[model samples]
Target: MNQNKSGPGTSLVGWNIKSWLSASVNTLDDADLELVYCGSDVPSSQCLSLVKESIPAWQSRAVNFDEGDFFVLSGQQKPVVIMRAKSPTEAQKRDAGLLAPSAYGQARDLVGRAVSEVRKFKSQKVNLRFESCQDREILGALVGLELAAYSYKQSVAAQPAPFPALGLSVKAELKDEAQAIAMGTNIARHLVNSPPNLLYPQSFANAVVELFANVPGLSIDVWDEARLQKENMGLILGVGGGSENRPCMVHLRYRPEGKSEAPLALVGKGITFDCGGLDIKDPAGMRLMKKDMGGAAAAVGTLYWMTQSQFARPLDVYIPLAENAISGKSYRPGDILRAKNGMTVEIHNTDAEGRLVLADAMAVAGSQSGSDKPAAIMVVATLTGAIKIGLGSDVAGFFSTDEALGQVISKRSQEWGDLMWRMPLFDGYRSRLDTNVADINHCATGSYGGAITAALFLTEFAKGYPFSHMDIYAWTDGERGALREAGGSGQAVQCLAGVLQSFGL
Candidate 1:
């Protein structure tokens, strides 16, 4: 965040924040954080609300704890705060150890909430800082939580709210803890929340390219129908056939300073607006389709951090933007469309267009003849009703052929606060998407595992790429938890971003 009279990071220490308070206690000594509590003396539930509500005032000043200083607050005998310094100027480590991981996490929630509250006030400055160790999972998550919170508030039209030019600086080594990830999340959320009128395919592509203009080692490329057709990206072409806006396949790449450790490719489904094509949805259903490109936004957010940060991995992002609107030229259900992979897909559901765009992008991930590719490639898309039905809006659904990759991703997700559930990749479900006339059908014959079926369909074209896909809801509401605000939270950015950093490729 911005520097201020508020004292963001601890000046008492060398500013190396290896740890910080996690909960609210009635007395200063009872807790390491002024606004949060730690033990049974105070319920963590109350602390949660305290965090969300108390964010405003604290932005003007962080909890001031001194190096090696010993102090206690009344009402509870707790070390309300501590400052990590160059020397053994502090001893709250013993006190801090008293609390379990659950309490520590509660503290993270409070800290993140405190940081997020300053979002709307673009004029005044907010200076809140949270301390964390390098390996602490929630450390990065708290940082991301604040960004997600601030970004959510920024999306509101009325957000012209007077808090400050809110800035959050997390003192941690994790990927999401960095400012780049926070800034990128805000930008991606803006892209997702922007109206279709403003964010057409070309404009969106330009926006993604523009996002990398100042960032070192980050680059972008936009391809038109001709480039797609030349490369045999029929799936993207078929879906874009109906839109007047024209389609674009956007590519973004990020290479680290040294030799790449583990190269990773990212693919995002960017259907800027889905009118359902010749097979159209009702006006109500189409209203929120402007966010059909949420996957692209996530990809952009993830790769944005991947490029700008010191992640040792070579990260590349591919986004295929399509606007599925009806025209005489629109591809219809029952019309078999050819994919870049040379597989035929029966148009069981024209509205199932995200997969089509992703199919083309996945097909492009390989060499001209499907030779060399990244060590791993993953796709993100808000592509199905089944995922929504299964995971609900509170969580995301994902399926990966490689269980090991899924575990790593899951670990990062916990750190980033994105809830993801792994569904089955059982081959038995593949039959539901089987079609007689084409190589595969877009939707399953039944709704048994719709999300799994959609994932399977996308996998059909990801032949050479080691790809995993996440079905993100992208929309938010209902909970008032710390740092968790209502609106389009960049659902999976933090998870993959942290994983990207860890993999160093």
Candidate 2:
């Protein structure tokens, strides 16, 4: 975007990154901000603090925040969390046909609408306004940018040249911390957008380890197909049987301090490309199956975010990456298979393999991640077609027995303008997944509640944990919307990061 007081774009920037972070830092002012383009080599802090500061400093005094150009996240305060500034005036003008007063309110309206669009898979490039407002406005919009970047792309090299990178003028706090978060998110964008052919199970685990090598107190363990078999992850082994490339279960542990009271476990479904096994999809249906592992990508994003920042609590994340391909060895329908959970699932549909592999990972985390009773295990995935039909691509479907926990996730997502809809885990839905010959069917009994049935299948595996499942259609588009882009978007990363930062969990 030109800086001619009235331009139509966004700019991003970065610092020496290392220099900005080396010194013990706290507090940031407007002077610390930089101006670069998104997707540029620019760097920023990996924590929430950096994202907070960038909003107001870049808007040139038009947008404001709750306190200053940036403010510390309320409820749980460790350091200051800067916000992006947004201009309701500029926003309304850009919206042209909008009907709202106050730039912030208009901002709320526009960004929210764009978020809805992105969720629906209607738009890809999400553009929001950030002005000289204190800081919240711009920060919030930037957060939206992060959310928009979550969709899986074939590869970063194939993606648009790059987004304009912007800098946050900070008061005193080390700006690199904030930029680090951006850097991490940007890297996540690259990882998720990569094609399945290049980013297989082991390679994907390698990427995770490589990304966080700099962070202290983080460890990663990757189990190849051999180890998984020996360890009794038959479900995972069975699903990966058809692939020429062996499957892998990657474990990343982030231990901050003292024994965790309730260390959270994040389980992501990493089906790099879902061929639907024997139950193959048509041409259009399988077009974007490469992004099947979006759930695992989000998990990777979350782990990286927490690692980059110094936060309390223990965090353990599991990513099960595999290509659910068809092969001679692929488990055939009607084949009764045993899992790490000791339960046998009669293969009703090989296409419904995400929940199968995820079951093993959840069990591994159950034995690991350090939680006895129930840990806050958030499982993310582009799970079912039913989700697309029920919530569409615009809204991520959330299923959790713990209403409070689900509410927190939803609220933070809403704040960032990521659309999330909570669906009921009605017991009646389970009947749809009942299998005549097996303990339970891999898929729902009928197409009537596809999304719910998938969630229901996952529930059986997550029974031991306080699990919250997000059935993201991973597609976007629909009626009168906010954003208008149609490509791989990096969505939901911000909301997850925001919630983690806000709750300091």
Candidate 3:
């Protein structure tokens, strides 16, 4: 299955992330427009003054300005946005509150609306003004503004219009890390939005190599079909049998100058285009299948930030990339495939291919940790629609065997505004994967608990380690405040990065 590798020659030609967007700190007086936050208890006079009396009477009512509400004032020379924030007493309670999961979520949504409003005027520069807000809150607002500014126009013909260059007006102390997180998210969005024709398995691997070419303490190795066969990755090879592009297992290692401890293992599911193999999907269902690799996009995007920030500990990232196309060689349902971990799986449905590829990747990640046994193993994937049905598209669902590790991940997700809900490992659901033949079935016979079954399947490979599986919908059907728009949302980038930093990694 030797195919011509068509992409840049060892250099990051199309992957250069520098020219995408830029952010800077400046004073409020020099800004082209202004954005302000008002608490729920703010006086009627203050609310009226913030919008410059341009809004209609009904729109300008004090009661209308509640937490997370947004209003625009366009009559003035410079447009101003007044967003309602938590009341002072509520803020104080949340600062020391035992349970306030919505604290950062409200801040993120409020800033997202402001970014959307600013974009309407095509203003390149913005002034963010919030009275008595903590530095962490400011950081969250900056992250939202930077991420909302992303627009992908790489394939336009004559000339697609360019997004207005974005600049931020804030104190100098709020410039660095916030910009890094935004840049990382934008990278994920760009990769996810790339055409599947240009971003095949091998091309995607090459892009990673080029993107991190000169990055210190970073090394990348890509295992092609031949090497995969030698290593007993039958599930990976079988799932990729229909495509000439072939599948590849990409390993990214990040070891800083003085770090020698075993790194945290992160695995991502990277199905470039999932046509469902012999069990082909409907034309409508297959439209956005190109985004199947979103899990891998988020993993690499998080690595980009970790390496750039020189995270304290090392990390190992494994991405199993392939295209599930249609051909005579396509794998069929009822076909039994053996994974690298020596587990035999009966394929109940060819469409359930993401877990197959991830099975081999997870085994590889687990083995790579050697005897140290990684502190935690986390896998991210767009693996199930059941999760969307259960949690909706706004939040990702995660499953973890370790309660302490799960709590840490949950808290960090809320703090970063990533919105992750912890689904149970539910050992009771383990028997749902029973099969008449082979060690287990690839998927459950019925649609119930698809998300849980998928996580249960993956857990078999993550032996002797604390594991967490994240099922995310990386594509947003529509805008949610300012944090995400109608395209690739880069769902788990911030959450994973926040988790790593929380572990002091």
Give the Å error, residue 174, model 2.
9.5
Error of 3 at 351 (Å): 0.7
Candidate ordering by lDDT (highest first): 3, 1, 2
Better of 1 and 2 by TM-score: 1
Q: Taking the tens digit of each residue's C-alpha lDDT, what string does model 2 give over 1-505?
A: 1122321112111111121122322222322222211111112232233344444443333323432223322212122123333323455344232221332222333343344333443322222223334344433333333333333332223343233222333332223333334444444444555677787777777766665554555677889888898888988888989998789988877676575566677788888888889988888888878778777877775665565544445777888888888889887888888888788888888989999998888877776532533366778888888877766676678888776777777666665555576788888877777777878778765558777877878888877667788876543442222223343333455566766665533
* Model 3's TM-score against the true structure: 0.87
- Summing lDDT over every window of 10 consecutive residues in candidate 2, give the lowest-scoring window: 11-20
lDDT tens digits by residue: candidate 1, 1-505: 2222221122110111111122111122212223222232333223233343334444313433322211122213211322121211145223332211233233344445444333322214333333333335335434434453453333343433333332333333443245546645655566676778878888887766654665555566789888988878888888888878888898876654666445577888899999887768898888788889888988887775555454546667899998898888898889888887788888888888898889888877754332225777788888887788876886788878776777766656654556666778778888888777988888887657778888888777666656678899877663333435555566777667766665522
The per-prediction tally of clashing pairs is 29, 102, 1
Q: What lDDT would each prediction earn against the true structure?
A: 0.61, 0.58, 0.76
Give candidate 1's error at residue 15 in angstroms: 31
Q: Against the hidden true structure, what lDDT does model 2 obtain?
A: 0.58
